[model samples]
Target: MENDSVEGLKKYTANNLLDFLTKQIDKDLMAALVKELGGTVETKTNSESF
Candidate 1:
């Protein structure tokens, strides 16, 4: 039972990290697109607003 709980926790943490990284990558891709299109990239800590 303890081992199962530990494994579950690990999986949850990994999933959350993966989601965070995916969002970051998406934001970076958007920034690149904006730069490519000759637009300004204004970065925010909590949100991305151009």
Candidate 2:
């Protein structure tokens, strides 16, 4: 039971960390694209205006 609990915690932590890293990477990519397009990133609640 304890081992299962530890495994579950590890999986949860890994998923959270992966999600964070993915978001960071996506942001970086978006920034690079915007720079390449010669536009700015304007973030909105439901959409992004460049």
TM-scores for all candidates: the values are: 0.33, 0.28
Location of the lowest summed lDDT over 10 successive residues in candidate 2:
13-22
Candidate 2, TM-score vs. the true structure? 0.28
- What local lDDT score does residue 25 receive in model 1, on the 0 to 100 scale? 65
Model 2 residue runs over 4 Å out of place are: 1-22, 41-50
Judged by whole-model lDDT over C-alpha atoms, candidate 2 comes out at: 0.47
Question: Per-residue alpha-carbon lDDT of model 1 for 1-50, expressed as tens digits?
Answer: 22546656544543333334446667566565445444455565855646
Looking at model 1, the pairs that clash are none
All candidates: CA RMSD in angstroms? 13.3, 13.0
For model 2, what is the alpha-carbon lDDT of residue 48?
Answer: 75
